[model samples]
Target: MTSFADLDLADVEEVAERREELLAAVRDHAGRIAYHIARVDGGDYGQRSFSTDDGEWTVKYEAGDLEYLRFEPRGGGETYVISTQQPAEPKALAEALEDYPAFVAAYNDYVDSLAGMLDSVEASFPQVESTESVVTERDRIVEAIEACCDRMAGELRRYEGTEYGSFAARIDGTRWELKWDEDGASYLRAGGSGGVYVLSQYGPPSAADVREYAPRFGGFVDAYNDHVAELELDLETITFET
Candidate 1:
């Protein structure tokens, strides 16, 4: 339900202002942007480091000099994709790291801004009636569900000669049910549990009948499908096939 615009990963700024942080940010991006030590003070670039949303990470590297540092990246938790290498320029390395404090801070903030925006977007559209744009979309899915119910009820009504029917979305724990009786339609019901919720067709009473008229529920299927098609959700689409 969340959109990309709602996230603001760009809102982050580098917070590292210490000598160690400068060295760390350099090492983190070093693989992509190569660097190595010229001075003998740090001793063979073993403690590679960089800044992240929460703080910093310094992976202990091998005690060897790097002539051609390759960008071997690692995961940055939920915030960044990090990597490290030791280039052969102490002055340039220190300069880069010195500048890195602001750069890393700004860079991380940018990414965080986007993440924040996405978070905001998702928070806005939590359910069926959450968005105005999705109102008509809901109508379409409801129409499909009603159509399915009608088809199901038709079989029951034709044989049993009574008025009772239902339609629903079958998620693992959320079973939203729509029903109708002789007194007309009733309020919709949304069920939640740890139980499995699979999309399945009911009624028709017998397997032979289900095989015969199962195609009739396609309209309801389309209604639910179209409702999702309208939203262009990024997570997973409404996958209901019964």
Candidate 2:
């Protein structure tokens, strides 16, 4: 809850000097340092991180207050975290630096482990085959589905009268329906239950609508075929008769 203004000016100056000293020490040891700061809760929060051949060091602060100083060694050893209400002292910083070499070694080992994991995963994958034949087979099935729909639509059109009429068929245990109204507007439904899907909203279903919707119906047919194939049952293609 302490604000920056509550701190004495001289004390703040001393802390700033110590911070610069710590940064200089880090740069001298690591040859490189990264510092970042952002506004947080109407105050400034910042972090400085630098790496040595041994490990990494991170210093975090809120305004001028030291939040925590952390040192994580490379590879995998114990992480040291120091938290104090006041800024870190020179002795504490020097002690943390002693573990830097261990940290670096641990980190390198971690990287090697990750590389080994990736190599193992890559080895487990089977060789992929060309997809051209798969795509051609899919196109062939879709064309056949479209043809079935077209034949069903043609048969529905041949039914006389504005009165309601419908034709039903069973393919692979699934019932399909093509129903028409007095106006000749047609609907198609798959399965014994569930509402019919209107092929044409404004008018009777057209050859164009059937062609456009064939791919969607082909998806259903494909899934059905896959289900039956998995059960070791014969795959059945949808067919219609007048």
How many pairs collide in each candidate, listed in order? Answer: 34, 12
lDDT of each: 0.41, 0.51
lDDT assessment of candidate 2: 0.51
Q: Choose the strongest candidate by TM-score.
A: 2
Q: Across residues 17-115, which tens digit of lDDT does each residue of candidate 2 receive?
A: 655565545444332211222222234676656566666766566654555657765665433334544544444444455655554455346446555
User: Model 1 over residues 1-242: C-alpha lDDT tens digits?
Assistant: 11123324343232222323544544455433222322222465554444544344333334443223222223322212232433323332332333344444544564465555545454465455555545555445555545655554454345445677665665443455545576443423445343222222331123332333234445445554664455457336668679
Cα deviation of 152, candidate 2, in Å: 2.4
Runs off by more than 4 Å, candidate 2: 1-12, 20-69, 72-94, 105-128, 154-172, 177-242
Instruction: Provide the lowest-lDDT 10-residue window in model 1.
Output: 195-204
